[model samples]
Target: MPKITYTQPDGVQSVVDVNEGDSVMRGAVLNGVPGIVAQCGGGASCGTCHVYVDKDNTKPLPEMHPVEDELLHCTSSPRQDNSRLSCQLPVSAELDGLVVHVPETQI
Candidate 1:
């Protein structure tokens, strides 16, 4: 399991131990974390699971697919340099301490 930290816009944080190979959105949804909606059930079709990868994370994440890149433009919040769909980020040992900031809205 890898420990991932999800921070809400209000600065609240939820630390969860996600099973290896599970998507970040799945981990948050299962743990009742209040930020990620995952409206598309990790299908990469919706931007509700959007998050901002912490600038402090040093490990490299997987490359974003073309569909995810296109969908990011539709997020309710403004897209950022670190913007990513949580459903596209899988849990891994290398990303054990990964931290992501959840936006205020996920419509």
Candidate 2:
């Protein structure tokens, strides 16, 4: 399992153990982390699972896909250089301790 940390706008953090092949959004959703909406259930179309990959922790993540590239622009939060959709990020050993920041709103 990979351990990930999700930080909310208020600085609160939720650390979760994610199964190897599960999406990061699934971990947050299953653990009841408040900021990740995941409305489309990991579908790339929703953009509701938007998160900011901590700039210092992003290098180990896989490259962003083309669909994720497009949907990121649809998030309610202003997109930053590190913006990413949690649903598009898969858990892996290389990404252990990955930290993502949740936006204030997903809608």
Give one digit per residue, the lDDT tens place, for model 2 in 5-81.
99999999999999989989999999999988888899899999999999887447778999999998888998899
Q: Given candidate 2, what's the lDDT at residue 20?
A: 88
Expressed as tens digits, the lDDT of each residue in 5-95 for candidate 1 is: 9999999999999999998899999999997999889999989999999988897699999999999999999999999999999888998
As a whole number from 0 to 100, the lDDT of residue 17 in candidate 1 is: 98
TM-score of each: 0.98, 0.95
- Model 1, C-alpha of 66: deviation from truth (Å): 0.7
lDDT (C-alpha, whole model) for all candidates: 0.94, 0.91
Instruction: List runs of model 2 lying over 4 Å from the truth.
Output: none
Q: List the residue pairs that clash in candidate 2.
A: none
lDDT of 1 at 44: 97
Q: Which of the numbered candidates is closest to the native, going by highest TM-score? A: 1
